[model samples]
Every structure is written in structure tokens, then in C-alpha cells.
Target: MTRTDGRLQVALVALCAAVFLDSMDLSLMGVALPAIGRDLSLPESTLQWLMSGYAVAYGGFLLLGGRIADLFGRRRVFLLSLAGATGYTAGLIASGLLTEISWRLVFFLPVPIALLVLAAAPLVLPRGVRPPGAREGFDAVGAVAVTGGVLLLVFALTEKSWPAGVVAVLLLGAFVVIERRRSAPLVPLEVFRSGTVGAANLAALAWACATIGWQFVAVLYLQQVLDYTPLTTGLGIVPMGLAIVITANLAGRLISRYGLGRVAAAGMLIQGAGILLFLRAGATGDYLTVLLPALVVHGIGNGLSFPSLNIAAVAGLPDERQGLASGLVTSAVQIGAGIGVAVLASMMTLGGSTLAGYRIAFLMAGGFSLIGALAAAFGLRPRRPAPVPAPTV
Candidate 1:
């Protein structure tokens, strides 16, 4: 690895910080879903779309975001993205359109803007720029295939009229055929061939869907089942925020010392256990017992594993391909969380009280996490080969 000058180091840190904030912002809504849904008179089915909508918008455009970022510069796009994301998130908080509100604003607005800024960030240092053909990257066919598969999975969870899942699957199958023949792909054909970064990313996506999606369902449980107010539901998730803050730094260090594979697996497994606790929740369950404990465990799980996944996703890429790798890894996370919340939310029914629906969601989260664990165990190796360093973008 080459040494970074002060400006490059600052830029990296700034972008990473923005990523953390964006990540938190995305999950924060899940914590309020129950209260928000009840207040808005939304059905569980409708709630599912709220999550899914953001995901579709984000996933659909990820490739373009990365490509643009590579052309523009990472720093510039990163800052602009931050501005747009902050603005749009505020819009979601303030908007009163109800279901008519566009989820696209919620998801697509920020990252793409960030990518644009990121693509432009390299202006600070002349050395940061790289010539084209330094290495081949961006597997277009792979991008289509992955996108199709993801969208299909998301569609399968939806009860919408469009049957988007079927289309997604067909598109994905076709994408697979395309990738086999294409030379420069969006997702390198070789990356998918490896169990480590590729599979870990997949597991990260699944785990994210389960863990991050919980806020929506759990919040609903608090308000609908326990009769907590919106403010209170927000407060309920506050503990999760605190836990993340406290543990993320520690998790980073643990990954440094113990390696990401074993540590991330443990974090995910523990989170799965936390979801099981939610399954045991009842209408009359105490708040401290049922809610706080589960969130603590879940939060710890998230804190421990997240950074590792981020690092893993771009581990072996050549220097110039960093932007693509970063974009793909992040796209997977947002898309996964979006789909998980959407699909699981669709499963919610009024057949039982808030407690009942929440239980099912938690179980679903656990299943996702378990799948992540298996994928991580088999695919994600912590001993990353030296990175193919990114251009300034």
C-alpha cells in the first residue's frame, strides 16, 4: 500500500464518516415504522413498500453512481451526496404525502449525489488520478445479474400487482448468461467466484436486511402492541444508537486484532439470537425485557460486523477499481436492507396484535442473519490480499 498524504487521508475519513451517517439514517426509520405506520393508518402490506421502495430506487441506479463517481471524483461526489442525502432525509421527515410519498427520494437521492461528489474528490491531489486501462473493471453483465437477483428477491416479498420479483428473476437469469460472455463486467466475474469478499458481501446484505429492518417492525410492536407513542417508539430505538456508538470503535479494533471472519460471524450469530428473543415477545411483555435487551444484542452484532464487511468488499480490487468495489458493496447493503424490510413487512398481518406481527418479523430477521452466518462462514475470508488501490475517485 502507498502512503496517503494529509489531504487524501482527510478525504477518506470524511467520506467514511458520511457513510456511517447515511447508514444510520437508513436504519433509523425502521425504528419508527410502527409508530409512523399506525399514525398514518398504514397497513402492514403498505409498510412493506415503504422499505422496498427505497431499496429499488437505490439498487436500480448503483451502477450509474459508481461509474459517475469514477469519472467525476470520490471527494466531490461524497460531499454533494451528503448534502443531498441530508436534504432528502429531512424531506422525508417533514413530508406529509403519506403513501404517495416517493421512496425514491429516500434512497436514490443521497448515494448518487455522494458518488458524483466522490468522483470529483480527487482534485485535491494530482497523484490521485489514474489513467484508464490501468486495469479492467466494471462488469456490466454482473451488475445486471446481481441487480436482477436482488430485485427479484425484493419482488418476491412484495404482494404488489406488478409481480416485480418474477421480472427481476428473469432479468437476473439473463444477466448470468450475459456476464459469461462479457469481458469487462460491473461485478467482476472473478469476485463472485471467490467465497470471501463476494459471499461475505452477500451475507452482509442478508444480515443487514434482517437487523436493519427490525426498527420498522419493532417500532410497530411498541406502539401498536404496547401503546407507546411515536416519540416513545423513537426513544425505544435510541438505545440501539447508543450501542452502535459505543461498540463500533471496539468492533473495528477487534477486527484488526482477531480478523473480520470469526468476529463478524460471532456478531451476526449473536444478533440472530437477539431476533429469537423478539419471537418470544408477547402483548404483555415488559419493555425492558423484550425490547431493550434484544436491541442491545442486535446493536452489538451490527457494530461488530459492519466495518469488516465494508473493508472486505473492496479487499482485492486493483487500485483503480476501488470506486466500483465500494459502490457495489454499499449498493448491496442498502438494497438488502430495503428488500428485507419490504418483504418482511409484506408478511405482516392483522391476524394477531402488534406483538404477533412483530414476532414474525423478528423471526424473519433471524432467518436472514442465519443465512448470512452460513455465507460468511463459508465465503468471507478475513485475510484479504493487498487492495488494488482506487484512483482519487
Candidate 2:
């Protein structure tokens, strides 16, 4: 391959490394939560903040991130973001192994990785490509409103703070008004005009809500209820990860043949079924009989659904708006994930972390997937071809 092609590939790796940091942290933190809680003497509600805080920050800034990339430069923003992604990729297993050492070490593990990524980013990522709207003013008001609004909303739901909830609502409402008035809005209000974009974003939100919350609970179930060690808890989830990797290879082909809507719908239905299967999990639940099958089923569904949702979210949009579409969908996923974890955490505490509470959380997660399925199946339907005029006419 040419030097240019090689550099481009390396740049892709750097970009993907940052993204892996985003998704992997969710699971890694889940594995560490029980240990973190035990060490800190924290409750379920508080333990969840570790996960939700990162998710909310990631979600809230995504739109602003895209806008920054456009205004500054993609490579510059990527390098800046890569600094944050820097951490040990070994967090999955390391979170377990390190938590044994000290739960604090788990948080420290990523520092070296970030430094390495930072050192390499300047070398790998290309420079000099500026977006058309580089001169446009930043939407500072919209950014603050959305970010603060989501933060407060998640805080309210998790902590049961009514006053915070009220402020969150007001801030979010103001965000809509602010965006509408801006000449170059953080997110253009017109993107939602397309049926596919709207539905696909909704589906993406629900999918993240169900899966992230379920993942959080699954780790707790294994470590807390089933009495597995942090290391064993980390290892136990391997089957699902394998299933996702295997199924994701096939998901691309399925989307190409069946289209985004059908594939997403089918995937979500399978995911819902998988979560519902956990309804049978008990205090004395058997790993082989109960958790293993559900994990694999859920993983396969997750693999299929994840990629399609992003594609559907951007479908039918003009080339210029593709970045905005991507940002919007990712924001939906992250925000939904934060809210889902908060909701499930509340459910678990309601039953005092008993098997009944776990069951309720799983049921609610399943319901989220079902909502995703409906959005994908109906909302993402392909538009009909416009009729051609007769030759005579």
C-alpha cells in the first residue's frame, strides 16, 4: 500500500481506539462496581454514578464535540479526545485484577494508555482539513443548557431529587428554544424532519438504555448475588463478548441484504427476549442453565442492533449533515444509557437489591428493547420511489 494509505489506516486505528474507550469503560466499570462499592462502603445508588457520570458527560458533549471538530479541525479534536481515551485496554481484565490490588488502581490503569495515545496521535492523524463552517460562532448557550440539563436529570433520577429534576426540565426546555434561535444551531432542528432519523435515534436511545442497564445489573448479579470474585465476574462475561464479535461479523451482511430497519428490529426483539429470559434468574440461579444462554442471546442481538442503529440514524440525510446525524445518535445512546442505569439502580434499591428487584430491572430493560424494536420496525421503513411520469406526457 502507498504511504498515504498506511497513514490513513493508522489514523483509523487511533480513532477507533478512542471509541473503544467509550464502549469498553461501560463494561469495565460494571465489573469493578461491586468491588468499588465494597471498598468505599457505597450503596447501589451511589455506585451507579461511576458509570452514569461518564456516560452523561460523553452524551452531553457529543453534539458540541462534533461542532468543535467542524470549527477547529477533525484531527485536532481527535487528538484532544484521544488524550481522554488513553488508558489501559486491559481494563476489562485489569479492572478485576487491579481491584484485587486496590479499587483505585483500576482508575489509574488508563493513564499510561492515554499518554501513549497522546504521544502517537500527532504522528498518525492527518492535518489541514478544515470544515466549511470553521468561521461560525460556537453555540455556547445550547452546550451549557444540554449538558447541565442531562447531568441534573440523571442526578435527579438516581438520587430521587425532585428539585434537581425540575431544573433539568427547565434547562432542557431552554435548550430547545436556544437551538431554534441560533443561525448555526448545535444540532439543526430540521434533521428530525426525516422519519428515519427520528425513529432510528429513538431506537438507538432505547437500545442503549436496555443494554447498558442490563450489563450493569448482570455484573452485580454475578458478583453480589452469585458470589463470584471480581476476576471470575470479568471472565464469566467472556461468552457474551465472543458472541457479539462473532455475530457482528454477520450483522453487516444481514444489513446489506435485509436493510437497516428489519435487521435492527429483529436484533432488538432478540435482545428483549434475552433480557426477559433473565426473569427466570433466582437467588440460587445456575450459571449454565440461566445466565449463559441469556448472555449469548443478548450479545448476538446487541451485535446486530448496534451497527444498524447508527446507519439508520444517518440514512436519507445529505452528506453535509452526516456528522451531525452521527453525533445525535451517539448522544442519544449515551444519554439513554445514563438514564437507564439510574432507573434500574432505583428499581434495585426499591427491593433492597433482592432477586425481586433484579427481576424488575431486567423486565424494564426488556421493555426498553421492545420500544426500540417498534421504532426500528415502523419508523425506519424505507421510503417509496416517486412515480415516474408517462412518456406520452
| TM-score on alpha carbons, each prediction | 0.78, 0.92
The regions of model 2 sitting more than 4 angstroms off are 84-101, 351-353, 391-393
lDDT, model 2, position 15: 67
| Candidate maximizing TM-score | 2
Positional deviation of residue 335's Cα in model 1 after best superposition, in angstroms? 1.7
Which regions of candidate 1 are displaced past 4 Å? 1-13, 31-40, 79-127, 133-149, 160-163, 350-354, 382-393
**Clash count, one per candidate:** 38, 4
Give candidate 1's whole-model lDDT. Answer: 0.68
* lDDT (tens digit, per residue) of candidate 2 on 1-393: 999898888777766666676676677788889988998899988888888888888888898887777677777887777654553344544666644766656555556656666776788877867777878877877988998999899999988899999999999999999999999889878888899999999999899889999988878988888899989887878998998889988998999899999999999999989899888888877889988899889999999998899888877687666667778899999989998998888888666548888988898999999999999999988899999988994
